[model samples]
Target: MTYLGEIHSRLLDHRPIIQGETRYFVKEFEEKRGLREVRVLENLKNVIQETNEQILPKCTETMQDYLSQTLQRLQAASHLVYKLQQKEQEQRKLNNQHLLISEKQRITQWEDFMTEQHNKQAAVDEEHRKATERLKEQYAEMEKDLAKFSSF
Candidate 1:
């Protein structure tokens, strides 16, 4: 766009040089030739001016509008991507928390199972000790009965 503007400016600046050369040629020729040459130069000037002032500016404005709309769409897409990333991060955090809670529950259940097993073992040991004590008492009573029978 800037290059187009630069070329337009250069054309405007060089208009006088073209007119000077045309005038020099008209002076070298006769009156009819000078008149025809001047009219042709005027027509060419009009066309160039219309193209520079009207057509170029309209085209430039259209290009600018297109670029602006494209930039807006790109920004919208970027915003959506950012929102999705945030949602994904939030989901990951929730999943991790759920896993931590589940692990804690599992660990608690295992501890309870171990404690119950220890309690059962302690009961079995106590019963075995009591049975041993009862057997020793029976043996002493049998020895005393045998001695009394022999004396009689």
Candidate 2:
């Protein structure tokens, strides 16, 4: 119903007899003039429909291209995220390995220091035992000499 109204309006707008008539009764128009206006409106409608048909495919193709490009970008972003996650995992593993190596080295150094201290303590104990034995021998010789002098 709206389409028919639009067609009628267009016909009235295009008619030469009705161009400047603001107050003329629409029912008073001659049948031949009305027919001519209707034909012109029908022709205009046909031209508009043909133009829309010609442009519809290009619009649809443009929309499809935009969607395709958007999908490609999303796929690329997804791949980048995956690669970043993998790299993070690799870095975490390397850090753990570095920590382990440092801990092992620290333990080894502590063991070496403990062994060196033990060796030094053992040498000091041996030297102290030798000095005590020499002191006991000297005291025994002095006691014998003093006894002989008293007898005489």
Index of the highest-lDDT prediction: 1
Model 2 scores worst on lDDT over the 10 consecutive residues at 22-31
- The Cα local distance difference test for each model comes to 0.90, 0.84
The lDDT of model 1 is: 0.90
RMSD of each predicted structure: 15.8, 13.4
Model 2 ranges with Cα > 4 A deviation? 1-64, 128-152
In candidate 2, what are the lDDT values of residues 1-152, reduced to their tens digit? 99999988778656656555633556445543688888889999998897788767788888999999999999999999999999999999999999999999999999999998898888888888887787777777777888888789
TM, every model: 0.44, 0.43
lDDT (C-alpha) at residue 123 in model 1: 87
Q: Total clashing residue pairs per candidate?
A: 0, 0
